[model samples]
Target: MNGAESLVETLVDNGVDICFANPGTSEMHFLAALENPRMRSVLCLFEGVATGAADGWYRMKDKPASTLLHLGPGLANGLANIHNAKRASSGMVNIIGEHSTSHLKYDPPLTSDIEGLARPLSHWVRRADSSDTIAWDTVQAVEQASQHPGKIATLILPGDTSWREVSAQVELPKRVAAQPKVPKAPDAARIAHIARVLQSGEPTLIILANKATRGLALERAGKIAAATGARLGSQFFTARIERGAGRVPIERIPYAVGQATEFLKGFKHIITVETREPVAFFSYPDKPSLLKAEGTLVHTLVEADEDSALAFEILLDELGAAHAKPVLQQRVEVVVPQGALNPLSIAHALSAAIPENCIVVDESLTTGRESMGHTMGAKPHDLINNLGGSIGYATPVATGAALACPDRRVFCMVGDGSAMYTIQSLWTQARENLNVTTIIFANNSYAILKAEYANMGAGVPGARALSMIDIDRPSIDWQAMAKSMGVPSVSVDTAEAFHKAMADSVRTPGPVLIQVRL
Candidate 1:
């Protein structure tokens, strides 16, 4: 078998069956190997979309998905989403194509440092030296990606390495049962210390992240909060959280520096879980970087690589709070607004229209910031946020999540400016016939930047400064753009229309776009 065939077979034999690919000439052999029925190949127009899709897949599937990128330039094109995925702790195995070894001596145009491009975002990076080693290298990459909380692993394959036939004498490597690197148990002393702190009667806030924000870990945290007076909080931007009616809700720290500082000032102690002490998203003039009040003590209950559920289980034992009734968010009825599509009205409409078991990918930095708070009591759903502060992540991530959970609908909320960054994601969604409802908030500007300008103590923006942030010079025809990509779409101006669109989109099959003109 050719090296590329072995690599594909190995990936399928292991658990990675889906591949997001944007290939070039150097990757043709590997692309051809994708014809293996066991491996499902998805074509992405941009490398960023491929990487972002892999991130989404890992988030929903709780497993690594493979991505095939072209040369160094291709990897670079994908780096932004890779940065987002790394920050989100989503597992992915990236196979980057490289020029053949012989061609490198001639200094070919496409030749560049693939390893250099991958290191900052990747937890593990390797290059296949020969055809016989490709399968082994792929196995190692998958193992790295499968670690607890997930990791990015990049495997570089030279052109010859993929096309060259493996020698018959070299027996093909069999799939080994990879040992999943589970999260280590927290120290008993540390758990006991935290238990004492919780019982101190001081107003404390337990900040959750990573694996601590969902499932049994979250329920245990709620019990701890119920037994003690501690409040549960989360960062402004978290990777993935399971929330909604019937789930334990977490208070999201405000996004703005001033607001966040104000919200956090009341806590006497801050306990961290798989995350750090609260800090401002960015530094501003005369503002403190840490959000906590003066003299507040910070304690670590669970390290990033530690088992949060286990820690909480032991903490429950120490506090005798295992039987404490945990507080759960009750379902609330939201009235859908009629006229005007402001943030509050939009949020209400969303809360009223969200379907059960939907996956919401949020990148509506400005308009939909309130959506989360409003939807807290809506139908049960999973929420994903941009932890890396990157734009254009919502649509592609929604695409991946929909593929991962084909039975569940995905609602992607992104601003017009951010949507343009990876609008190519629409085509892939359409091609895959994914169950994705993409909502584009067409505000005609980088509205968040406009807010940041004032937050930075810059006076009112001048005409020139406003021009830089505004995209109103020629308004984008979002409907036409959606049509070009073969996805059915609708335009909404009123809250009622938006609410109706959201409710109706899920009923129809395949991908649909809703352009909310604000």
Candidate 2:
């Protein structure tokens, strides 16, 4: 058996059934081994799409998928999304192919520092030293990626390793049945300390993130808030948050420093669970880096690696609030607004049309910032924010999410500029016949950059400066773009038109793109 075959077998044995790949020459053997019907190989035109799709797959499937990237340059192209995946705590196995060891001394044009590029984004990085060890390395990579909150495990494979003959595949130890680690219970002293702070009834706020923002943990958090009169909030940008009608809603700390500061203004204590204390996304001139008001104390009930759900349950028990019914958001009627489409009208249209059990991938930049509040009580859905602050994620993530959960509708909201970066995802969505509704906010400019320039205290931009952000030199025909990619699409300018387009897109099957022109 060759190393490539054994590597593929190892991954499949470990439950990694899918691979997103943008392969090249060095990966030829690995690519050939993919002929095995057991492993599904998805061809991504760009490395970023491969990585971003893996991120989406992890979020929806709760397991890591493998990605095959070309050498250093290819890994470099995919780094931004890898960075985003790391921040989201999404698990992925990145298989980067390198030149044969002998060729390295000759300094091939493609040769570069692959490990250096990978280390920044991956929690674990290892290179297969020889063909005999490839399968063993593959097994280790899967284990690293399967941890509770998920992680990125990168394995660098030299070309010679894949081509060489191995006597036999590594005989990995018999797998142990994985039991969800029983979270180490918090001591009575710590629980009492948190309980005391919450019961003090003096403006305590609980910040939730990661696992704490979804499922039963969120419910217990709501109960704690209900019993102690403490408030609940989350970071402005989070990986995935379960929120909608009948669910306990959390006040997300605003993206703007001033607004976030005001949100946490009077709180005397901020309790953190699987999330850090509130901090601004960027340091504004003369603005405090910390979002909370001065003199506010930050306490941690559970750290990033701790089990957030159990921690909150313990806190609820300590407060005698286990049975307290929490306040939940009532269903809000979705209404189609009249007149021209603006941010507010756009939000209203989405609030009305997003389907129940839907997944919303947001990269709408400035336009969709305020839209979350409007969708609070529409229907139960999962909202995925760009925790890594990287652009071009919405479309690919939507593609992967739809593939992961075929029953749920996937809605991708992206701004014009960001949409262009990964527009190829639309073709994949169409080819796979996935259920995806892509809404491209065609404001025809980098709206967030313009806002940032102003926020940075820079004076009004000149014609040249404005030209850099404005995308309207020759307005992009998004309808044509989608149609060219084999997806049905339409352009809409008014709120009613957008609402109709969205509703139609969701009701119908396959991929559809709605270009909302403001």
Candidate 3:
């Protein structure tokens, strides 16, 4: 068998069955091998779509998916989203095709350094030197990606290596088990110190992230808060947060430095679980990067990658707070809202319409910050964030999430500008008949960048600069776009209309798009 065939067999053996691919000349051999029924190849219009879809698949399935990119430029085009996938701890094996060794010596234009571009975002990187080693190399890449918390593994395949015949039979390597996490116990003295602070009646806050955002860690944090009267909060943006109806909700620190500082001002002590003291997402000219209130004492109960849930459990036990009941759990029954639509009204409508056991993929950057708090009491659901802060992630991620959990509804909330980044994802959703309700916040501008410009100390711009921030010279008609992509759609300007549209979309089976006119 050729190297491409062996590589495919190895990935399938390691349980990576889905491949999101955007191929070119260099990848033809590997693409041909994809005829094997065991592997499912998804054609993506853009390299970014391929990478973003793989990311979404990992978020829902907790398993790595592969992406087949043509060459250096293809990998480069996909790098932004791959950076995001890496930050999210979403495992993925990127199979990057390269020119033959003989061709490389001539230094062709496409022969740019692929490894240099991939290293920053990848945890594991290797180039197959020969056809005989491809199988073993692929096995290692899969194992690395499948590691606990997930990782990015890039395997560069030279053209000659993929097409050449191996004299000896290739063998796949045995997969290694993920290493167990060992959480550090909070020191007794530190626990006693925090207890004294809580008893002292000084205002305090307990921040959470990672594993602390869900299940036992959240429950334990609630118990501690109930017993100690300390405020519960989380970082402004988390990797993966488990929240919504029936879950104990923690307040998120605001993204703006001034707002976060004001919010944190009352706390004299700030305790953390699986994260550090809160900080601004970006630095303003005169504003402090750290968002802690002046004089607030910061303490760490657990570090990220440590077993935060276990650490919280131990801390609760240490505080003699075990068995303390959580803050009362309540579920909000869906109630369709009325009135004209805006950000607030749209949030209200969403709170009333979100379905139970749903997965909400949020890339509606500027318009969706309030969504977390507003939808906190809605039906139980999983919330996935754009951990890599890249635009055009939500739609594709929603596609993969729907595929992974066919029983659950996937709600993709994206800003109009961000939606355009990977709008082609709509076609994939329609083709698969994925249960995705894509809500596009049609503000027609890069609204988040506008906010960032002021935050970055740039003086309010003249008409020319402002024009660059705006996208409305010719606004896109999302309904037409969705229809063209084979997904049904509706445009709404009022809360009632949006709610009805969301309800109708969810009640029916296939993909639907709701354009919320701003």
lDDT of 1 by residue, 1-518 (tens): 89899889889878899999999999999999999998999999999999999999998988999999999999999999999999998999999999999999999998898999899899999999999888888888888899887899999999999999988887765665255568888999999999999989999999999888899999999999999989999998898898999999999999988888889888889999999998888889988898899989999999987999999999999999889989999998999899999999999999998899999999998998889899999989999999998787888899889899999999999999999999999999999999999999999999999999998999899999999999998999999999999999999999999999999998998999999999
Off by over 4 Å in 2: 169-188
Model 3 is weakest, by summed lDDT over 10 consecutive residues, at 174-183
Ranking by TM-score: 1, 2, 3
Off by over 4 Å in 3: 167-169, 174-202, 333-335, 456-460
What TM-score against the true fold does each predicted structure earn? Answer: 0.99, 0.97, 0.92
Tens digit of per-residue lDDT, candidate 3, span 101-216: 99999998899889998998899999999888888888788878876567899999999999987656555454332233244554656566666666677788988876677778
* Winner by lDDT between candidate 2 and candidate 1: 1
Ranking by lDDT: 1, 2, 3
Candidate 1 lDDT for residue 397: 91
Q: Pick the candidate with the highest TM-score.
A: 1
Clashes of each: 0, 0, 0
How many backbone overlaps does candidate 1 show? Answer: 0
* Candidate 1 global lDDT: 0.92
Best by lDDT: 1
